[model samples]
Target: MLENLKKEFLQPLEEFTPIPFWFWNDYLTEEELDRQMLAFKEKGVDGFVIHPRLGLPEEIGYLTDTYFHYVRYAVKRASQLHMKVVLYDEAMYPSGSCHGQVVRENPAFASRGLRMSARESAEEGELLIAAVKREGKTWYFWEGPSGGTIRGVHYGEDDGEAGAPASADLMNPEAVALFLQLTHERYYQELKEYFGNTIIGIFTDEPNILGRCSKEGMIAWSGNFLEDFYRQGGNEQDLYLLFADTDSSEGRRAGERYKRAVYERMSRAYYRQIADWCAAHGVAMTGHPEKSTDIGYLQHFTIPCQDIVWRYVAPEEEKAITGEHSTMGKCSSDSARHRGKRRNGNECFGCCGAPEDPYRFTMEDMKWYLDWLFVRGVNMIFPHAFYYSLRDRRKEERPPEVGMHSSFWEDYHIASDYIKRMCGLLTDSVNQAKAAVLCRSEKLSWEIAKPLFENQIEFNYLEEELLPSCRIENGCVLIRQQRYPVVITDGKDTPETRDFLRRLEESGGTVLVWNAALTAQKIREAVKPAETFLPPARDLRCTCLRKEGTEFLFLVNEGENSVTTNLRLEDGHICQIWDAWNGTIKQLELPVQEMKLSLGQRESLILVTDRGE
Candidate 1:
């Protein structure tokens, strides 16, 4: 068993690496199904996500007897081929509505939101109005007035202008319960025999509260929000203030607190409930949250994930402008590392090429994306999709099939092997970070995070929820195996964080109060910089992880030109390079304290050692 485990660890495509064949049930046929799974196995793919998506014919019928029959065939074939099966919870994505089937049965269960629109009233009369909140701004409306009330309710609808199927209210427990019964429970009932064995877990897509929320002015609402807010120590009158544009400090504070309460209630109603359900059913819940940069909410996922969309640009450009979309991988990875999760996932390679230049995603672009993910500690790969049929319209649905039909299909295993090799090293390894920055808010945290990323200062974003588990020990904030000698507090300090800083200071740890321009002088003052790794020039990213007394240092070149770098270590040290290009681990003997290395454009390298080796 030990030898077998070791052998599996060395070559983990089947069990450890999860580039699951996304079996889009478009034109379901037993022969075609078997062929796809076997084809995936040939490409070193070892798992499949049974996704029933658009273009699936009406005759097959989603979640029907025919659907189950196809599902059984796929799962059974995977079992025979020694591959894993992960169930996609919904027929179409942005889950929770069960493809609008859930809300269609009961319109009351459909998602709801508060909308604020203004129109001129012909009658000149004084009217009492209630204020409503929309995207952090307040809008006012007359109470029960006719013709043109500024504040009116809007039912949940698709992002498109045309009326479509309504999204289920995730904040409503009843609506979520119905969703589970109609979708999740149905999967378990049909696939119970393989739940924990061949069937590994279920992937729940982002079940956002308001699907494709309006950009103009909209706020989410639930049937039980008012009472729940009051019960949770929120003022009933202050709720309206949350929707109002107030300049007073007290009013602004009240609005922030009330909005936070609403968010907490939604999380409890949706994520906590889904997590509990998955735990009970002997499966892991793996999926991204609606807003991936909301780090605190990531704790609810069993295998925290984020979706990487659009094009694969340089990391530096992504950091400068992309905001939440780009930094999602780091957010999920930090959340997972803090909670000791072994695997973090990403739904990547979607729309890599622009719509006009479809099927133009080169293998090099995929490599760059993979490097970005791995550097941030994302180990699991959900390669966006794999088509069950490239026939007719199914060919056009989420086109540029990166799987069996792509131009590089014959050489898919080359990329597959590299991903698995890197992921195998990342999994079960302890993160080696010496500092953490308080993730006060997304904007401020990213502001401070920019300098940290550019300088290659490895750290994690410490959320307030992780504070209780952290403590100052020997002049450092200690949590499990991770330690931070310096903790940077950015923006307005919260009372909780202020208290934490005081405790940390009293315990002889250092804290850097963030200024507008977070200069290197401030960072240098907080903690003396080390010389473990340095490049001739900047724009290189590196991260460290330790497992079983061996430390792994991963480095990537983020620039266009080849560069030479020196890895500083103890004199006469021995280091082994995990060369992805050659697929070999070659030993390195260092004569001096710094070892020089030359990396090509868009290239990366990993070094393994145990102090002197």
Candidate 2:
């Protein structure tokens, strides 16, 4: 399994091959495009994502005139050199998605961005459950106006008169039908034949739909959501009906539940819509977040439903926050007063406040992002972008208008090398989701206190004292309603743990306490006589070092004393030592038959064990 995993990890990665650089808005000159690819090819990049400049004289149609020529030429050229190619699908940003910007730029574009206006009257909300006929097909529209403040996003020179207070009026069935239809025509329909497998799937870049702000909310969706919600025993006959008033405690709970359910339905609609379309077309789809807060959703429902790994702003944010003397942007606090707070640097930095240092793609950033995303269930990435050339540009190529206006071209090689190395470890790690804590449907801490589940982040590891009785899975200490015998490594066993362990053992569960805390009486007290969460009546003991199912258990010396001790999980259970992280197993060379897995102050060792090895 390990070997197969390694092979799987390297195979897809060996083929991933991102196209090096691009010259986005540098519209004219096919000659220039060729020149860039040729230069990138010389630098050893095996693939790329190229697109035409928007609104160029030639970009009037789907792509610039020689678009296909460029694509076929690049593909043919790359193919000759054994490389892969990807076309930055037509258009860019909020409107480029579905030719939404094709119509005159909405005066509302700069005004509301994607906010909604006004709470829907109950009459309007309830109508969301009604089936409306559009083009002879009855479909569901949005149930109500969404609530949000559209005062933020900028669109060139602000002619902001606040526009009309608007919302994502999916409640208007006509709009819902058109959205679904447009999805089919724009991305699906014949995308399979158009790009075939060469284009692994549709990259649904930024799919923000709110046109204005609403105190109620303004998300867009099709008819399937409301009906499905009702079918699942929800009474949202009209979306406009305020299921819960968030103004008061009780109302807030109800509103939260309503919003959560609706968001789930809406999010799933998107996942399924793209997923189903992708499966049908023989490809997989990928998407990024509208904001950084959506990473949890991506872990549980969003990315899992899609085949590819997702990207988040954490990497950049973490970098900016910890980089040298730099501090996080003032707006990072999520405070109410942080509005209108730009970093005042004309470097044209985006969300993370400053651009990534192009010539120096930091390894520290790569390691943090890789480990973080891995634990979050993302096994793949397209990264921010790969430009065609680091060429100078001033005009818009198309919708996104995303130019390679950075040091990316110079840092190209290092970034690609880092990406390739990381992919090699990640691709095969997809199947490593074998063991996980089943978040209880009741208390629901897992829903909100999600960081605990993804506690592998370097600074976020468990504090053996606070959450000692935690179950080891995917580098996290799993906590639940009852006490567990599983050597919870993070904190001292809580008060309820003793009884839980006793019951678990009574039920044939084996409770193994971590050797790291054997010195503490509370640690032993936490593991009751009877086991609860593990096998019953099974022998359990502490091992200075042991192995259990693909994980290594090393009881580190929390105190600064070097002590040699006998090691064993159970009598005569002769443990084996292997280092899978580097593929150097069976290196346990010790005369006492007890090899020391050393740890200094705040040090740790992973004693991995796999069954049937």
Maximum-TM-score candidate: 1
State, as a TM-score between 0 and 1, how close model 1 is to the true structure.
0.88
TM-score to true structure, per model: 0.88, 0.52
Error of 1 at 18 (Å): 3.2
What does candidate 1's lDDT look like per residue over 562-609, in tens digits?
768677753335356776644666666642446787878768887765
Error of 1 at 40 (Å): 0.5
Give the lDDT of residue 240 in candidate 1: 56
User: 15-34 in candidate 2: lDDT tens per residue?
Assistant: 53433324343343557666
Query: Any runs in candidate 2 off by more than 4 Å, and if so which?
Result: 1-13, 18-23, 39-44, 49-81, 85-90, 95-97, 101-194, 212-244, 264-269, 289-368, 374-377, 389-414, 430-613
lDDT at 123, model 1: 29
